[model samples]
Target: MDPYAWSWNPEGLVVLLLAAGYVAALRRYPTPWWRPACFGVAMVLLLAVSVSPLHMLAMQYLLTVHLFQNVVLAEWAPLLVVLGLPPALAAAIARPSAMRLLTHPALALPVWLANYMIWHLPWVYDTALEHPSSLLHLEHALYFLTGLALWWSVVQDAPHELRAGTRAAVVFGAFVLVSPIGLVMALIPRAIYGFYVDAPKRLWGLSALQDQQLAGVLMALEQAVVFFAILAFWFARFFAEEDRREEIDRSPEAA
Candidate 1:
């Protein structure tokens, strides 16, 4: 709870340095200012959730806070970072043989889903908490990375570029698969994580079970916002494209 004691982890340092380097590169490449700004804000958010008092709060006090961190890092941060990339840079990144393979939904979906489920397993979760030095960071990194790869398949290619129907399916499918985890967490009467049960956390005088359930509710709510927004956007784009194609087909030149 000592907000003064902010963490300065190597991962935070790396994220900052990469953002710095990317901003500098923008000068040479002449990319849009908003692009770097998106990246910069994403990095700041990364530091906040992972390295600030928020980090301590999650690590020691509240499971709900940790869940929030995971969603922000995995879902929000990666999506914004991908959106921030210049088209050329995005294309370059996507052009690689291995990158292409990993970004494909066939490979990305199960990896992301597994990464998510495995980390929640009781033993695995406890081990991560036990080893703050390595495994914890690994867990966070996996969350961010698998999310990045997952979002890459969605955002890097525009809605019109990809099969909009397929993109919608992936997003909706993820929503369905991930919601059960949250629902399970919320409905369970008992606490799940051992560390959070008695750990110096009495925020709002809430019990561990209450805190855990709140986390689940937040996760479920967050998934709805994220996935549904993406779905709405894709469907809108899909229908717009359809309308345009129909217009072209009915044009006088077509006759």
Candidate 2:
């Protein structure tokens, strides 16, 4: 199959169904323009990665493409999806006891970290590729789901929105925890994923190991940029909150 040709899968249908459901839900709740905007972009990203030529390249030709796809699924798409939720909807969802417990930073952070690391293990990664019928879908599903779980506390104004200081800590901690995987993938002497190493004559005249290294470097850099950007936002919010509290404390009414 031509690596650049567009391919449609059940995944595209899934994205559309999600969009449809979201649209239906919006009729009942007043939503800000930005909420739908975030959701629309996320669905577009999900659909593009599922149906565009990029999906083909990831499935067949390049680990770099596949890693890029994973990053979108696990990081970019999920963050936007969470951001897209209306605050009323988010509060409703968070009201569930189970969701409240699961989204707690104590649990969400570790689950996301483990999910991120476990899927990248060479044997696991290679097996998912080899058996795309079953495991590949599972892999993608978990990435998206856990990503929702991961970002829920950070983005949602829900049952327990994290304090700005705590949110900054969680984002920074995740950045630190996940950095090692990318570093290992980049610095390792060889391509660890056998399926990629064994793929047909590599495109762009690149060997498997070189492609793997590039994927690793890109992944690390992407994480650093995304995480630090969020960290800065949260830190700013933290400082602002601190200033507000200090101002109230110094007010004559309090005195």
Candidate 3:
């Protein structure tokens, strides 16, 4: 099987697009020095792992490589992109009309959860690995988009949005909802996907089982970090709002 035999082309194109999007976002946002630079480093690392020759080379021989690919795709990349905020691009694309659509209570949350469930199914996951190029491309795009929506509702500095407590509950609730998927991945006895079973093993001397364990660890860590970070921010905002309300209450006009 020619690993590069157009099977990887779509993923390559996706990597290019993500890089371009990152650059475009930076140009539009004028992000603070620290945030943009950090985001850039994360993006570069993620692209290198996902689409660069190094990733292809690793994919040829290692379950660890496959595990790394999953982690980079589903965890690291989303987290970094969320932290970047990409507010400028989001704002540009999110016209008042689009914002209305995205903010629609009837539309956003269900699509978000549906996308999450569809992608992580074992059949869907195996299909992507089997096809390697097209399915994987679609999978990555959906993963990134769903992640963006999830984080946007919880973290983006937007106006007239869910209150901080609600945001915290949403983030934490997502973490809990996804926990079963992680456990499924961890507990499945036999290799569910043929791709990993056939792939060469390298890096950290991990077997298929160990590689799967690592994937579970990555997923769990990602969930924990995202949930806790949102919770902390939510609490801080909540307290700040309370303090402001108290100050207003104590003002001379109120007295």
Candidate 4:
């Protein structure tokens, strides 16, 4: 089989089922058009990265592509999924005790960070990639789940609304903690994951070390853009809240 040729992944079934469930939910609980649109876009993105040639490229050919796929799974898709959840639905989901505990900022942040850090460790990363029984699928699953949990505290206003300042802090802290991983990968002198080095297909004539560096750079850049945008949004909200409070204080009724 041609390494770069388009390949289909059975994993697309997971995305399809999720889309179907969301459609059913929409029928029962009508929402603004944008909600479903956000969800549809996210599902399509998930399908594209998982079911399309991107999946095959990441699995068999390039570390750079794999890193890109990981970012989409762990960040973009989860964020969009959270954005798509209507307030009523989010509140209902959060009513479950287990979900409340899982999405709590205290637990969610650390777990998400750990999930990300542990998977990227050289031995662990290689081991997952080396076997078809490949802990890889598990890794991807955890990434998506933890990513969802991580965003819950920031995005979902129904279960518990964090103060705007607090949300900004959360985003900033997460960026601070996670940024180093990619920076280290980019700066490291050698390719850390042995699996990529031994893989049969080398695309674009990139050496293993070069590919590793490229992946790290891409990961770092993407994280910076996404995290900073979120931070800015929360900061704007924080300032707006403060302005509203000041206006209330200045009102004749307050005096």
| Leading candidate by lDDT | 2
lDDT value, residue 92 of candidate 3? 59
TM-score per candidate, chains pooled: 0.92, 0.97, 0.77, 0.95
Task: Give the least accurate 10-residue stretch of model 1, judged by summed lDDT.
Answer: 158-167
Candidate 4: misplaced stretches above 4 Å? 252-255
**lDDT of each residue in 1-255, candidate 2, tens digit only:** 687899888899999999998998899877989999999999999988899998988988899999999988999999999999998988887888999888888899899889989999999999999987799889999889888888897878686867899989989999999999888989999989999888876898889999999999999999999999999999999999999998988897766
Candidate lDDT (C-alpha), each: 0.82, 0.90, 0.64, 0.87
Model 4 Cα lDDT, one tens digit per residue, 1-255: 566666555557788998898888877778898988888888988887786788778888789988888888888899899889888888988898899889888888999999999998989988888764448778888999999998988999857788999889888988999988889889999988898998887889998999999888989999999999999999999999999998988897867
| lDDT score at residue 227, model 1, on the 0-100 scale | 92
- Tens-place lDDT per residue, model 1, 1-255, is 573368778778878887887777666566778877887788888988878888888877888888888888778888888878877777767887888888888887889888888888767877798798899999999988998888888877722246777777778877888788788889988998887876764776778999999999999998998899999998887788889888988997877
Better of 3 and 4 by lDDT: 4
How well does candidate 2 match the true structure in TM-score terms?
Answer: 0.97
- Best of the candidates, TM-score: 2
Give a tens-digit lDDT track for model 3, residues 1-255: 444422345565666776687777676577766666656666776677666655674456444455556556655566576566556565655557766566433455566667767766767766776775587668767766666566666666553366777776776677787666656667777656566656754445767676666676666666677667767888888888889888988897776
Off by over 4 Å in 1: 1-4, 158-161, 252-254
